[model samples]
Target: MTAGHVPVAVVGGGQAGLSVSWYLGRAGVEHVVLEAQTPVHAWADTRWDNFTLVTPNWHCRLPGYAYDGEDPDGFMTRDEVVQWLAGWLQTFTPPLRNHTRVSTLRPLAAGGFELTLATATGEEVLTCEHAVVATGGYPIPVLPAFAASLDGSITQIHSEQYRNADQLPEGAVLVVGTGQSGAQIAEDLHLEGRQVHLAVGSAPRVARFYRGRDCMTWLADMGLYDKAAPEYPGGKAAIEKTNHYVTGRDGGRDIDLRRFAVEGMRLYGTLSDGKDARLTFEPSLRHALDKADAVYNSILSDIDAFIEREGLGRSVPPATRYSTVWEPDAEVTELDLAAEGITSIVWAIGYRPDYRWIEASAFDGGGRPMQNRGVTEVEGLKFVGLPWMHTWGSGRFLGVDRDARYLADNIIDAHQRKSALESSALRASAHHHLAVAR
Candidate 1:
């Protein structure tokens, strides 16, 4: 085991981790980032082949960098994002130790931390005054309970494992959950000549347009794309809260879920009645569309106001009121997967934060780490990248950038103050020992 210690250590090198590292570098702090996999491997390797980011490239940049290329509005393919991150890493030059896995973290007696890390070369122990856990949530693919009951002949794969349409079974595919991933996967599978059945669930309301202009343009104009914490606190929360449910970039504008229904994409309402052998469909997809449209419009209006007040220019168009085409409660019933030949189900349900690795006992009964913004009840321990960590934007890509920066700054301030006190105490103890010896 290596005997050295760093002042600060970061575990996980995803967007959140990288953002924190970038800020730390800018602060001239010596820190090390331990990445279990190559940077952006979660996005690069664990996504569908046809997948593209719903958020435009402009909003994709980590701290200390901006996606300032020719196609700012363009959605980045998984590979493009990986390359972008790699390039950003080169520019920032954060000390990244790749393929290093952190097993556990324990608080030391002298007001610091001891980290147990396992690497390809060997195990190593690292001591640090501060540690940041930036492991982004999307680790395991969640499957419904019914997955285990399926027949052995049936093949099931999550959206994470899905690469191309060829990986699917011969028959129709049942995609569960209608979040961004599920919607995109369903659309891709349908285009690949596979019959697709999508089990609708609680999808957040979304819009096809950004502000009065396209959503992408509005995001850029409002600086939501390049937002930093402490600057636009309200804006950050909005982006983080809503970014996960956004869809419709890769397949184009007309291919949005609402538009796709008009163009012959099968829309089965929520699947119910497990006992019934029959499957039912909603008469219209309007209810879901209406809810989504309203949310989208509200977001645009907010952006428009923010832009106008901030004097950011009219890069975004004014908000337009569009009539919703929703019809009340259409009864769609059970999608019988066993009877149909559909063998795979892709559950693209959104992620929940799992902080099981956080050993501090401050977690609430709900298993959520108890934190107020980045500060926790535990002394010298802090958290970043939590949903609604402070303001609305506290956990978005742009939002977390701010939150992490704030946390890093606070950590430095606290560390400096504590170090001074510790030095004073040591000197006092030495004086007492000398007097006793004399």
Candidate 2:
């Protein structure tokens, strides 16, 4: 075991972890970040080949760094994002120990924690006054229950596994989930000349455009996205709930789902009596389609107003809509891989936070750790980059910057107080021993 201690040890090297490390460096705090892979490795590896960020370049900045370039509103491709992060790391020069996987973390007798890290050569024990688990969620992918019942002859793949349209079978592909990933993946497959069927679930309410001289502009002007203090009540819960998932707003100029429907994508709702048995769209699907269109229109209206105000005519293009219901060019059916010869099933549902490495009893029945702002009930432990760690924006790229600063200040204060107490206790014990000798 290596005999050394650091003031703070951060696990995970994604956006959240890097943000914390940036602030820690600015504060001149001695710390080391442990990352199992290169920074932003998940985004670099998992996204489909045609994927681009829904958020514009401006919103993607980490703490103490802004996305450097002229095109603030330009969306970065997956590879571009990875390259930018690599460059940003060079500018900040955060002390990150790559390939060091932390196996477990336990509290020590004094105020701090002992982290067990597995390295390339051997196991190493490292202690820090505070342990920050900055592992952002989204690594573990969830699949639907019906997937297992399908015959083994059919090829199935989650959205995370999909890289491009070439991997899919020649016949129609059924894409589950209508979230940003699902919508984008379906669109990409359709572009590649494969018939695509989208399984509509609870659809997300999304903005139509990235930004313009309207509410979004106003929000940015007022610095609404900036980090803030944690003193506000109920602030933390709000921040945690703010969805970070991509949405329809990221579509480049002129693209609209209604227009895509008119051209040919099939939208299906929950299966009905015997329709699903035969792999067909449910009878009730028509009603659900109507409802989804209404939501889409509302988003489009807001976008239209913003476009006019900004005079971004060249950048913004007109959207299209399907005036009437149209049957699929191919056919919309329930996913039965074996019978239909379907090659892939993209699970665009979402991600679950896995905190198994944390053995502390601080977690509730739901597996969420109970914390007051960033402070947990357990001492010497803190959390950052959690949804709503303090306020509505707490977990946002802009929001997390604020929480990290506040958390750093609180940790510094706690460290000083604990040091003073330990010194006082040692002096008192020495005096008592001397008196006893006399």
Candidate 3:
């Protein structure tokens, strides 16, 4: 079946796609947003019950919908975030097709592209002059090959599947990967007085507050978000680094792994191999902890420099420092899950992009679409919402609007050009016929 055609079609009705739709609407561009589920699906479904934004509420800017809440400094819980997203959707009321999944997309032989959408009723084909893919960067969770070797008695789940400590079976829990989700989930389990074992990765940690200001606010003020990925110290590779672990829960605070260790949470190094109930770990726990602290202090030092350079030493409070409260005396390289009473494992190793449905040559070896600020070499193809698309905030709610606006302008320009060319050809044909009659 054919669902007709459109000038523009946006895939994925998440924040990214909705932002683009808002811009297209403002410009009077006719477009339809195709979403596999509800627009607020991710916030509604994947997140844990207690999940809150690590960034401040003030950063929740989606197009014209800048956060106007009373608590700009506070974080929005999962439900609040969903409401905020839905609120934006209601404001514009853009054309949206819910429960419509774009199963495959390929460039047409001519100027447009063909999309195969799967819905509850049946399959439908739709063609569009331009397609904006805003399906986000991370789509699939990553798990170690050894995860399958674990005993069947233990319940294993990805971080996206984790809800709260009560959801897991009664007993000790082992949380792997110290990225943002891993670290925060470990803390959540620890808070419930569960015997939590954390397998720490090299992911860095950051202070929640600095100089009486939220760390994110200070960083923004310091122009960190304005810096492009390539301009970072490590260049483009820095864009791929795992986000620093911090939390805005309970009115915001630092996620200090060392503090958790001091409080009796068993910390292990990176998990290496697993078989049945036995798991082996590397002896880099101390190094990983130290490296995390070093990065944390380095950020503080940068803030201090920014304060000194701005000559706001008096206005801002004195610089605070983090101290190493606890460290592993020696590496505990192995643990038997059965003996340790480990009943569940939460794998927080992160996610990778899946562009397999998009049969286009715009992808790199790693499956990331190649684009410059969301505009690709493929004429009518574009992308949005990938991390570091142009700046540090590109994929985030902080700067997605800017990227969307740019793409909207590009689409408008293309339409104008096509109309002008067609008008010129029509006039030329008319003149030729008149000359032949004379």
Candidate 4:
């Protein structure tokens, strides 16, 4: 095994990790970024081929690597995003160790952390005074046990593995989870001339464009994106929820299960329970549909209120509505995917962060990393690019830059404090030695 040390070790290499590195360079801190794959891991491998950013080009904030192009309002494709990140990495030529997966991160007896990494060459140990867990919010997929209970004939794949409809087996698809991924992937399948069953939960959505302005621009103008975690009333649950459901297909359109339903995609309630070849849904299907409508209405209400406050006289078209439901009061709950001729299942149930590598003190009872906007109780340890770490947009491309800068400054301050104490101790030791000699 090889061993080395750095003042700070960033445990990711996506936009967040690279962002932190940018500020660290300005601060002149000796740091290295450890990545399990190539740079921009998510953009490169996790998303579908036609995926595009929900946020516009102008919102691609990466500190010194801000987006510079003619189409600021345009959305970038997945490949475009990867290329941009690759080019940005060149500016700093960051000390990045690619394909180095961190197996464990524990506090060292001598101070700081011992990061055990598994690399191509062999096992490697990296000692760092300060550790930054910028390893993004979605590396691990959250698959439900029901997926295992499905028939052997059914192919189940998480949203991360889904590329296109043609890539899967021929037949109807059951898309579980109505978050951004589930919604978009369902639409992709439906447009590809395949029957799709989308299981939708209480997910909020907003129009992609209104009043000739992007919804994101309106949100940004209202300073809603700047809201901190404390500003959220329901603590962690509220903070973790993101208000994103827009689409980049069809020249940047709004996507929701309701719209998919109108487009002929069958919608189901949340996946509640399942047995072999059998799926059960919560009887709250109507409630779930109403909840979605309410969330959409709330978004529109906020936008209208903002427009009124700003005295902008642009008239908005009559609000679009789904105004429909399927089996509103059905007594049946169990769904047989095999009987329904469902061939594949796409699990888009969001991500559960894996912090097994980190020590116990670094996390809360709920497995969430215990940190105050990336600065933890562990003196030399910190975090960045986590949802609700500081703001509503934390963990997103536009907001990661701010969080990264904050953590970088925080790490630098810790380094300075350590250096100061060491200098004082050395001086005192020298004086004591001279006095003893005399």
RMSD of each: 4.6, 5.5, 1.3, 2.6
lDDT, candidate 4, 326-427, per-residue tens = 434353467888778898999988888788778748777767887888888887888888877888888888789899988888887877888999999999
On lDDT, the leading prediction is 3
Worst lDDT run of 10 residues, candidate 3, spans: 229-238
Local distance difference test, each candidate = 0.67, 0.67, 0.92, 0.81
* lDDT (Cα, tens digit) per residue for candidate 2, span 53-95: 6655676666667787876766778888888878778778778
Which candidate would rank higher by TM-score, 2 or 4? 4
Regions of model 3 farther than 4 Å from truth: 431-438
TM-score list, all predictions: 0.80, 0.78, 0.97, 0.92
Clashing pairs in 4: none
Candidate order, lDDT descending:
3, 4, 1, 2
lDDT of 1 by residue, 200-240 (tens): 65565545554434565555566654544345655645434
Tell me model 2's lDDT, rounded to 2 decimals: 0.67
Instruction: After the best TM-score superposition of candidate 1, give how far the Cα of residue 405 lies from its true spot, in angstroms.
Output: 1.8
Off by over 4 Å in 4: 233-237, 314-332, 421-438
Itemize residue pairs with steric clashes in candidate 1.
210-214, 210-215, 229-402, 236-393, 237-392, 237-393, 280-333
- What is the C-alpha lDDT profile of model 3 across 157-270, one tens digit per residue? 999999999999999999999998999899999998999999999899899999989999999998888787778767866677889999989999999998999998999999
